[model samples]
Target chain A: MKQSLFEIVSNIQIAENVFKMVLSGDTEAVKKPGQFVNIKIEDGGLFLRRPISVCDCENAGGSGKGTLTIIYKVVGKGTEKMSRMKSGTLDILSGLGNGYDTSLSGEKPLLIGGGVGVPPLYMLAKKLISEGKKVSVILGFNKKSEIFFEDEFKRLGASVKTVTVDGSYGLRGYVTDAMPKDAEGKDGYTYFYTCGPEPMLKAVYKASKTAGQFSFEERMGCGFGACMGCSCRTITGSKRICKEGPVMEKEEILWED
Target chain B: MGRLSVDLCGIELENPIIPASGTFGYGYEFAELYDINILGTFSFKGTTKEERFGNPTPRIAECTAGMINAVGLQNPGVEKVISEELPKLSRCFNKKVMANVSGFSVDDYAYTCERLDSCDQIGWFEVNVSCPNVHGGGMSFGTDPNAAADVTKAVKRVTKKPVIMKLSPNVTDIVSIAKACEDSGADGISLINTLLGMRIDLRTKKPVIANKMGGFSGRAIFPVALRMVYQVSDAVKIPVIGMGGVSSAEDVIEMMLAGASAVEIGAANLVEPYICRDIIEKLPEIMDKYKIDTLKGIIGGAK
Candidate 1:
């Protein structure tokens, strides 16, 4: 992870405690599907590092070595403090966690995510389109207030579908509820990929017919695997959420009720 | 400009700003971000005899200027570190690495040090006696004068390496603990691991950390950290590595003036990922502004 003090091009509060921060840094190591950046919020104010989903990666690893984006909700003090920070500069540890595994994703694939979890899905959707793959995304949020990144995904040419819990927008229900009922019928979907809360992840695992990958959101310490502070039990054994995955295969997930 | 170096025991460091353990992983990770050669020496993660999974969730919490951690010395075991981690580290960080060894008991510390004695890449042995975050090992061995002495003496017996015993700040008498380890044959002393701290979830009526209690560090504790370091330095004649909530080069100046020969940037590393390098680069600029010519002049100059 490159800990660079990136100038904030823009930082906006999308929801109450949720914010979207765009920064300039080494975006080259961030080309993959499920990668994340560990954000150090409020200089040295917040002790623990906060991990946010990579909304998109720009400039890859070129000379400019350009921009990085992350969207997060104020789950606690870290994000709450981050929201108060107006546009200026950010000292950040970016390019953390093993993102998504794109090799298993076929030409025609399905992506699903909910709420703040939708951040990384945006990057994954764009990647699939770049690979000349037919990508479809199902996104869910609590309500219209929680919705984010619709037009951007559309601009990427990924067939994007939206869902909400309050019947406020798109398909009125959860993302799983919006899963093409004909998923088993005709569409040639090679694999499934998803991220969100544990509940949404469980739904994605249960609803998908084909094998998929899930990005698990966990409170982290080092944000690297060395701490073993973010390990979640899987079928194989205990795996570090930051290392083995914030992204893990659907088959390996051990859903905790 | 003289020897930009420090001799901790017989082991020579090109400089004095070693990256504190836990904050700096095996050095390769940070080396990938920037050149590790710029550093004096980096302390590796605390390695126990057996593999340690570390503490539970909510291991870190941010306070005013610093953060607290309950990482519980999570490591991949001593054998794995010597075999796997060390080789990877050798390729990246050209500087000597002080192996910060932590254990639950005195024997544990000795065993791990004995294992590390064979590796020449290890420039020194930093016995982790000051961790307030862990349940049994940290301040438990550091706070008690007798235990601290016993643990230091045991490790010194096993190896010829210069052993620097890290002293905790959570005790009633910080000087006593530092003096205890020094009297027991420690080559040097590192002061002020995070102080004991606690935070509450007012909304939930529970503690914020899963561990209920954690170690506090950062800008908030600099004054307290300086005081302890000053006291410990006066109490003992050994070289001291002082750190609390050091974030900038100014803090480094203050620490050295207070009597630390070197300083470790702990919570600052968590805050600014490039702090290890940032501080090193900033030190020269800071030194220039203050009309300082030698790195040695700043130590113990406070009136």
Candidate 2:
């Protein structure tokens, strides 16, 4: 992992309390799709850095120079301060947490995400499609007002479907409710990848027909894995969500009932 | 040179800034960012006799100027640490590293320390009797003077390396525990480990950390650390390694002045990944500002 100063190109409110921030910095550390960046807030009293996943990254100025995009919600004081920031340098710890393992994706892969979790899967879907893999995406949000990145996901050439809890948009109910059933005679959706809240993740884990990968969210410290603050018990053993994974295989995760 | 070198027990450190255990994972992780050989030495993650899975999720809680963590002692155990972790650490760091050992029992402490002593790269055995995350072990051995001395004596009997008993700050009288360890043949002392603290989620009306409480550390705990270091260093003749909420070069000098031979940086490293390196580079400038030429000259100077 590397720490560098990122210049905030823009911070815009896309949804109700959600924001989309584009940053310019050394993006070399971000190798995988689900990897995150730990942002250090320069406020008076906040000492801990806030962890946010990489929404997208591209080499902007040249081969070594690039810009990173991240989506965050104004959950507390840190993000509230972040929402007000227009243009400034942010001290960012890049290439944090083990990202999604795209190599495990089969020919036909299904991607599922909810709310803020939708951003990481956008990059994942893009990478999977680039590899000549057929990709399908399911986006879940509370309502139409909270919906975001639907066109962004569709622009990447993946078949996108959105689900809302209030029936205010397409395919009302949760993402799990919109999950496609297994076809009888053919190998449908050889593998699945999902990122969302704990309930959604657990539902996806139970509803998935094939071997899949699940991304977990936990309150973290030192997002690079120094502090064992985000550890979760798995079938193998306890794994740090920041180190071993923000992503884990379906078989390895032991969900608490 | 402004005499940055420090003698902890018999081992010499290039500087007094050692990254506290659990914050610097086996040294190799941080070495990927910078040349870790520039450090005095770092204490690797807390290890135990058996591989521990550590506590459950939501183990961290952020505070005003600090963070609380109940990471427990998540490690690959002593055998794996010796066979796997240390070899990777040796590749990046050429200096003698400190081994931080935690256990559930006196024999557990002795067994783990004795095994770690065989590693040539290990300079000192930092017995962690002050971890608050674990239930039956860790802080249980540290909270009481007799238990702290018992663990210290047990580990000292099994190993020939310098033994520094890491003390917890959650106690009423931390000096008594430090003296007890020193009286039981502890080569040195390191304090204060994270203070026990907690936070509640107002919406859910529940504790933020799954463990309900965790050890709190950061800039907020610096004064508490300095006071404990002063009290403990005065009470014991053994070299004291002061820590807790130490983030800057000035804090390092102040800790040394308060009677610490060395200081460990914990939560600050989490906030700024390059903090230790930055502090090391800034130490001389801070030393010049304070009109101090030698760091060792300031040890216990405040006392």
The most accurate candidate by TM-score is: 2
How does residue A217 of candidate 1 score in lDDT?
74
Runs of candidate 1 with Cα error greater than 4 angstroms are A1-26, A38-50, A65-69, A74-93, A151-160, A170-173, A180-183, A221-244, A252-257, B1-3, B202-205
TM-score of chain B of each: 0.96, 0.99
**Could you tally the backbone clashes for each prediction?**
8, 0
For every model in order, what is the iRMS? 3.0, 0.9
For residues A1-257, what per-residue lDDT tens digits would candidate 1 score against the true structure? 55667778887987646788888766756656677877666553456667777887788545555988888887776777777776777766666778887778887889888888888988888777878888888889888888878777888898888988898888888898878765555654788888888888887777778888888877666676544556666798778787678889877877753
Q: What is the alpha-carbon lDDT of model 2 when measured against the actual structure? A: 0.91
Q: After superposition, how far is residue A253 of candidate 1 from its true place, in Å?
A: 3.9
Q: Candidate 1 docking category?
A: acceptable
lDDT of 1 by residue, B71-165 (tens): 77778899999999999988987767889999889999999999999998987899988777677776799889999999999999998878999
